[model samples]
Target: MTELDVKDWLVVESLQSGIPLTDRPYAVLAEGIGMDEGEFIRRTADLEARGIIRRMGLRIRHHQAGVKGNIMVVWRVPEARIEEVGQLLAKQSSISHCYERPMHPELPYNVYSMVHAPDPEAARVEVIRLAELTGIDDYKMLTTVRELKKSTPVYQRPEE
Candidate 1:
């Protein structure tokens, strides 16, 4: 959106999904856009340098990949200790994603974390270990019940 011309915007659109899964993916992508492969790669690099693209990564379906357990652990951390405890949770190898959030009046969870394990019992054990590591007793482990859709976002320009 930031000064990207029609062709560049189209390039970004193509990139939103991913390069083709062929042997020469970039070549296929460039060919699809009627562009030279080298130029296409250069433009992508330039776009990244300009911060137009934050990350170009794959989203794996962990369950399909034989990773069974997925637990979301929320911590009711005190304001004075949230940062210290949050860092400790984030450093855990079993933990995938962790962040701090606004504590609800009734629910009162300030720190959140995502842990992945092969089984529910393993996830529970890991969550318990994380609790002992952080010394934050008040926590909950919520298991994933369903996965509706797992696709990378493709941005749509809103009508003026």
Candidate 2:
């Protein structure tokens, strides 16, 4: 991995808060961070190319966006059918994230997906739809009652 310089750290810190919601978001961000728009863009591209930044995209604030129903449905998918079932779940627009995780002895579920809707009941309906679509009914819905902390990891210069 390429080492990040001072400017790269600045760029990372500036971006941690999120890109400005504006007509010219990049320009606004670059100006705020005191860098030329082209340079800022180039540095961002370089960070991505070097694998320092794995992914960058818009993140929807589900709660603020009037999406009250958010549930994480964990499925007990057969090891052999993990891929097939995971793909089916991923195709649905309501499913934000779907992945196969290592299962614990106590918790037998392996496949997990984040489902969102307008309300909690609707979210449950979506979960049922998913269960039917994937044919994997042995599952659990983990809903968030209160979000204590939700934030991106802020990068800081390491102490020598």
Candidate 3:
């Protein structure tokens, strides 16, 4: 198991809440956690290097950003070509996410991608272009009718 001191835990907690929208967000966080900015950065880098912290990224509000169309494209990639096809899908700027999932009898498509576009027509064109680029014709594009829920995960430490 990974060992983390109270200060490290405090850093994690501070990060979990949310990154401040400022010119020097990291410095602000470090100050709040009573750690020097350089030390905080070093600790974060160390955590990432050790594989404890995978990655930190932002969530784009597509709707608010004039992206009215969202499509989930599921590709029927051959087992032997899953990784290659997934990489192709991931390279597209329109495709925000690409993932491989277990193949079930009912649903044979294994590789899925989330595509964002200004409208449905553009989204379909992008999907068609993706199919041509990847040479994977077997796929389905499920359009978003409505978004029921979307939120980020919040982590909490066990009571000590």
Best by lDDT: 2
Per-residue lDDT tens digits for candidate 3, residues 29-118, read 999878999988888888788887888778678778898878999999988999999998888899989999988889999999999888
- Which model is ahead, 1 or 2, in terms of TM-score? 1
What's model 3's lDDT at 148? 98
Clash pairs, candidate 3, are none
Please report, as a residue range, the 10-residue window in candidate 1 with the lowest summed lDDT. Answer: 151-160
Runs in model 2 lying further than 4 Å from the true structure = 1-6, 17-37, 48-60, 157-160
Distance from true location, Cα of 82 in model 3, Å: 1.8
**What's the number of clashes in each of the models?**
0, 0, 0
- Ranking of models by TM-score: 1, 2, 3
Tens digits of per-residue lDDT for model 2 on 65-108? 89899999999999999999999998999998998999999999
lDDT for each residue of candidate 1 in 57-80, tens digit (9 for 90 to 100): 776777789778889999999899
lDDT of 1 at 1: 47
lDDT of 3 at 62: 74
lDDT of 2: 0.88
Residue 111, model 3: Cα distance from true site in angstroms: 0.7
Q: How does each model score on lDDT? A: 0.83, 0.88, 0.87
